[model samples]
Target chain A: MKFFINKENLLFAIQSVQRAVSQKSPLPILTGIKFSCEEDKLVLSATDFEISVRCAVPATVEESGSLVIPARYITEFARRLPDSIIEFEAGPDSTMAVIRYGDSEFNINGYDASEFPSFVIPEEEFSFKLDADLFKEIIKQVTFAVSTEESRPVFTGVFFEIVAGRLTIVATDTFRLALRHTAINEETPELINVIVPGKTLNELARTADPKSIVEVIIGKTHAAFITGEIQIIARLIPGKFPSYRQVIPNQFISEIKIPLKDFLESAERVALLAGENNLLVSLYIRENHVVLNMRSETGWIREEIKSEVNGDKLEISFNVRYLCDVLRSINYEQLVVRFTGPLTPALIIPEDNKDYLSILVPARLSRE
Target chain B: MKFFINKENLLFAIQSVQRAVSQKSPLPILTGIKFSCEEDKLVLSATDFEISVRCAVPATVEESGSLVIPARYITEFARRLPDSIIEFEAGPDSTMAVIRYGDSEFNINGYDASEFPSFVIPEEEFSFKLDADLFKEIIKQVTFAVSTEESRPVFTGVFFEIVAGRLTIVATDTFRLALRHTAINEETPELINVIVPGKTLNELARTADPKSIVEVIIGKTHAAFITGEIQIIARLIPGKFPSYRQVIPNQFISEIKIPLKDFLESAERVALLAGENNLLVSLYIRENHVVLNMRSETGWIREEIKSEVNGDKLEISFNVRYLCDVLRSINYEQLVVRFTGPLTPALIIPEDNKDYLSILVPARLSRE
Candidate 1:
């Protein structure tokens, strides 16, 4: 596009959009960033069929024009350019452009923007305002439990359920489930449910500013998030999300409280002794303390850490990786482990945070 | 055997030796770290046939004994263990050991020390002392030019020449050469030349203390460096190193001085457009400015930067990677570029320093 802007401003805009550029797209144009110039601003966008991102920066537009430049070259070039005014002029042909800064000038090749697909967000009838930090935290806690395999599309997404002035997000790969709920002020006409791909949520969590207010718009098949200077849209994973409410246990035979950091540190070391693939570790609930035991062909490690225990004594074995993930995603000091039985799933929650919870199914201890 | 050692001290000793642990050793004992406890100190060592490293740390030893534990497991376990006095007690048999710290304990399996090879350094008839920082700096400047391919064993190591009161290190892959020399006061019985493997030099550079005096001992089949609390001995690559004195021309047809950072920044951008495999770029050295041009199947980029020229104009092309490496490794503000011809090699040296030099051969330019 024919525009003159600051090097830093252009670089920031390009980086925000280039995150969605596809490295192995079937169509080569999708690997480029479409640049458009209007009267006083320039817009940049990139898409990979599933997720699209766009950002606009203030620039002096000489003439309204558009072009699609290779994202990699443009980003690297702009980043390396000295901090000064950068001039971009679209060439007469569809395959060339000129960039000038100080005494340095480059005639770069580009594709016509006419061949690029439109990334305009359609008008949506339903939308809600949410805190960026809270949304990011919910995504962090739930995204880890989403199934990585694509065979079951529903499990590959984080389930979103909103009703009665509260929002709850759930994700599971059948072995473990993470559920987090937070109170919101938005009024809904009815209960709303949607399945967002884990990839999109992760990107949103990365790009969103902690203190910024994000407006989430849900359309027929697509969802758009409008943050500070960027807009990200992604197509929803089409399928019915699993009902995880029934998977959580309602009663517990024993509940023990342990320091979160201590427990996570011990489990991490114990997992190392559990071999590489099978991360099995046993937890024994005693009257005064709790013990973590891990064994493999290499050796066995037993860690006894002081804890506050109540209710019936029990012993359970689980994949220590799940427990570590839950602990890392939390910012609380103490974690309560609620056990239903040795064979069933256990509920783990932050001692001071009632809105967050995780359920991990115990694995059968193997005899070596 | 039993001993109580601080976790941090034990961790450091294990890490220093683990660098030589062989991942693909034919004998499994070579993959373990041999621990020898006697009197009031513990020694840890590992060897991979080509290189051997050992370090000792002070500890209270109740009984004198030795054991070889898997390097990977012991290092990782000690790193995760809480920072405290850790008690280690060998089982009745060499195959089992118990480690306790705080309330955590681990029963680990290990191999007997009898299977480990001896890494004792023989009495050296000749030795020289050098500053660790100076030695490390010399290695950093010249080692990048070492040939990575094992087909040419001679080029895979850095050529070390000691004569009179000077030490010169040279490395080259034939395309480009990096040579650096420094003055030392160590009295040598006679002039000596040896080739030290690049891997060994790199490890030595990383582990050597910057402020300590390093004692270098040259043996018939190996070279040993003793610094601080660590001793590293590496087998030398046997072969006649190519004479690079003839490659460094004494006279130059033209010499151009340029601001190192400014030149590097512009060249980096031009290199990005040179594509993946061939990073070819041409520098047009005019009377007042230098123009860098890069062309590939994807596109072409041109950048012109100002410079101080003192001779006839010339145009030369080179693989920008070699030039970039020299610039990044140097801390000098001004760089003097000496040119012989468009086809011959060029010399680059720090403007204020005479002990460092690099010669880069020009490449055939590809016309757009």
Candidate 2:
């Protein structure tokens, strides 16, 4: 293979695909990124069994061929090259590749391209296009609530459910749940339910550009997203997601509207005095004020903030970290909090929009 | 104790002293900062046995007393407080401290002030005032070469030697040495030698302001530096530092001058192609040009840069990381490299000044 490309373009393509490359894999070929040169473009691909990334860049190709090179070494070399045109050529023995930029040349050892695994995408699947910015925002809003513990594999992913014209993404780790809903332009009669790993969604969110348009294709066992010159394919987690609708409380005995910034600041302060391991925080709501109390073996802290309270006064306890995560994820000025009882789950929503909701389970109170 | 102070001023003072506090110390008092409230000033002190920092801020004192509060918690609390005057008072039993800023209040459990270790700065045996920027520059130029290994405790510190009107600082780890010298105004009859820990010096360098003068007081066992409202005292590392002057070659058989930026960039590129471990780079100096070579199991990289080489042509090999460190530390336009032989240490100095020098020991050739 022989091709010439700009340094910055080649570096960006390599980095986009490098996220899926595995450093240590049972299959040695997985550590190499397959490079293919065609008539007018060069494509780079890397996969680690669960996810794969492929990127194509415009290039001047003198010969069409394929070669697989070590991912880390080539990436580092390409990144350090001067901002000039880089030329890559495969040797006749197919055991070495030469990279030349400016007056420098790098002879990198290559692995057999035939040993690389072939990844295929289904031709017929549920496909739709969405704004990259919205998709990335949805992932960021819900992915943080996914469970890191692998004991419950289904809970380690975000649940994506689409019905009619509205699409909702939800993630829950039992302690807290984040749900974001948006209306799509496409009309689909089929009900789509799939659990995508939180980690893969996070990577997509980071790589996707904010103002770009992205096309998403979902199949029986895998999902793919195409953004600009990059295509990302991730294996879907095969399991039945729990029914979260039943857990969301429909009615509340008390509701309060508080400034989001003020509440977040007060919670962070009280968290400093919370328990080291449990990080428990107690909320005492009375009339038009809410008091946050935290106690640890070392000390205790109490902070109060004024709010617009309605219904009966009540008290609830929760993990301070869980609440902080929800507050940080929501970019809203005012938030409405609804409480059912002392032990029931509390729901928080943005005052201007009801499409997003955060649910938190109350901590068991310790008798003193 | 009772006092009120500006939140910003108190936060700055607390942050400066908190640098000396470590949470993993065996002595519990080391994790707390002593707060002494006098008639017009509030002094905060924290120590980790080896180093201590104390800073004072002006405050309105209703009563005079002292207490020790947990460092981490207090710092975090003060940083997040509202932008207003903060009021602090000790409880009647002297076991708890109350802090109030704006509408927020934090009550923290306190330790007895008597339990805190006393950091005493005796009448200075040798006192001198120096330009903070110049002192900071000297520290930055040489401190990176200090040994990180704990086997040789003395090598982990920088040797600060003062003779007549010259101040010299040297750091080495056997394989490489970085030396920087400057002229002071005072001419002392007695020579002074002290080894200060690299960690402490780095912290001092960061905290010192570049626009002001810093008063340095050296005692028999400690070195105290007062910059603005902050004072730092660190115990000296008592041991014999190696005589690095003997290792520097006095007579050079070959010399080469190269642009610093070009040399550093080329070295970085060559380093990327070196092996993951045991990276050795070879430099071949000819009559009119220099070539950098690195060959590893994975690949090989060769880069040539034109330079004005004098004397006999020579080839030498050294660890790439060492050369990169020295090249990065020097902020000069051109650097002159001197060498006696292939095995002798190579000296690198600024083309315009003789006050700084970096020496690198050659690596043994592999028998493969």
Candidate 3:
């Protein structure tokens, strides 16, 4: 393979696909990135049997061929190279590629191209398109609640469902749940559902451009997200997702509307005294104000933030980290929190945007 | 103890002394900071036996008392507090201090101040003063070469020797050595020599202000550095430091002058191909040009840089990391490297400065 590629373009392509490169695999070939050169573009692909990524960049090709280079060396070398035209060439019979720039050259040994596992998009049963910005927002709002415990594999993935031109995403870790609904461009009479690993959604959020449109294709055993010149295909996590709707309460005994920024600041300050082993912070809601209290072996702190509170006065205890996460994720100025009782789950939603809501299970307080 | 202090002032005092606070100590009092309220100021002190720090901040003292507060809690709380007057009070017999600000309050438990270790500056045999900026610069230029091996305890400290009106600092790990000389404001008939641990010098460098004057008092077993409102006392590393002057070569067979930036960049790039086990990069000097070459199991790369070379043509190899450290520490556009032979130590110094120089031992090549 022979091609003269711009340093920035090559680096971008490598970074986009190299996230899928296996760090330590039994098959050594999976640790490399496959590089293919055509008449007008250079393609890079990497996969670890879970998620596969492909990215194409414009290049001036002299000879068309393919090679698999070690991801570790090439990534570091590309970052340190000067921002000039890079000359790359490798004979069809040779497994080593020579990269030259200015007065320096690197001859990096690689595996045979035929040994690399090729990734081909499977036949899609359904496809839908959405704004890249909306897709990123949806992932950010719900992925944080995905369970990290691998024993329950179904909870480790985010659920995606499209029904009647509206798309809904949900993620839960048994203790808390997040749900977001947005209007999608595609209309499907039947329900389309898929469970994608949380890791895939995070990578997509990082690589997707907000100005472009993203097309999602769902296959029987895999799913693909295509945006501009990049495509990410991930294996579908096979399992039945828990029913998330039944956990969200529809009624409340207390509803408190507070300024998001002030509430977040107060919670953070109170959390300082909440010992790491037991991150419990109690919220006492009154007529027009709410107070946060936390006690640890070393100290106890109390912070008060004025807000509009309604319904019966009550006190609820929760893991302060869960409250902080929801406050930081939303951009609204005010938030409404609904509480049913001390033992029931509390629902929190942005005051201006009702489509996104999160539920947190109250912690059982051992002491008053 | 009762006092009202500015948030910024309290934070600065905490940060300055917190470096000496013990993370985990058998003596529980050492894990806390001693706060002493005087008529006009509040004094904060922390010690870990090896190093002690004291800083005084102006405060409105309502009463005179003392207590030991946990460093971990107070430091984090101080950073997050808003910029306002903080009210602090504790009964003479109570072990808990109540800190109040706005509508927030923190009641932190602590130990009696009587249990904390007291640090007292000893009588100095000799003392000298220098610009804090210059002291920081000298520490940075020499501390990088200090040995980290605990077996050789003497090499883990930087040597400080002041003779007449010149101060010279030297650090070496036996493999490489860095020496710097600068003029101080004080002159004494007898030389003052001491070795300070690298860890202490690094902390001193970080806390010293550029606009202040630092007075260094050398006691028999301890050294004290006083700058503005902060004072750091460190136990001197007792041992005879190895004589460093004999390793420097006065004459050389070849002298090469190269642009510092270009030489540094080339060395870093060539070092990428040098295996981590053997960081050997060979420099081939011929007339007015130098070539950097490295060969590893995976690849080999060579880079050429134009410069002003004199004397006999030769090739020498050295660990690129050692060369890069000296190049990065000095602020000079051009550097002159003197080489006696392929195996002899190479001397590198700023082309325009004579007060700073570094020597690197050549690495023996095992194969061609």
Candidate 3: Cα lDDT at A272 = 74
Error of 3 at B171 (Å): 0.5
Model 3, B249-306: lDDT tens digits are 9989999999998888778777677666768888899888999888888777787888
Task: Compose the digit string of candidate 2's lDDT tens values, residues B1-368.
Answer: 99999988899889889989977998887789999989899999999978899999999999999999999799999888878888999988876899886566788998989888887985677777789988788888898789999989899999988898888899998888999988888776899988989989999989898997878788888999888988999888999999887888899989999999878988998888766664888899998889898888887878887788999999888889888988887789999999989988999999999999998898876533
Candidate 3, number of clashes? 0
Give one digit per residue, the lDDT tens place, for model 1 in A234-342: 8888988877878889999999999988898898888777667558899999997899998788888999989999899998999888877777777779999899999
Which has the higher lDDT value, candidate number 2 or candidate number 3?
3
Q: Which model is ahead, 1 or 2, in terms of TM-score?
A: 1
**lDDT per residue (tens digit) for residues A97-122 in model 2:** 88887666788888888788776764
What DockQ results do all the predictions give, each relative to the true complex? 0.71, 0.66, 0.65
- The DockQ-derived docking category for candidate 2 is medium
Q: Which residue runs does candidate 1 get wrong by more than 4 Å?
A: B366-368
Which pairs of residues have clashing backbones in candidate 2?
none
C-alpha positional error of residue B338 in candidate 3 after TM-score superposition, expressed in Å: 1.0
Cα deviation in Å at residue A258, candidate 3?
1.9
DockQ of 1: 0.71
CAPRI band for model 1: medium
Q: Give the alpha carbon lDDT tens digit for every residue of B1-368 in model 1.
A: 88989998999999888989999888988888998899999999999988899999998898889888888789988998888899988879976778898998898789888878988784674678888998888889998888999999999999988888788899999988999988878767688888989999999999888999888888877889999889999898999999999889877788899999988988888878865666888999998889988777777778888899988799999998877877777667899999999889999999999999998999877653
User: In every candidate, what fraction of the native interface contacts is reproduced?
Assistant: 0.84, 0.77, 0.77
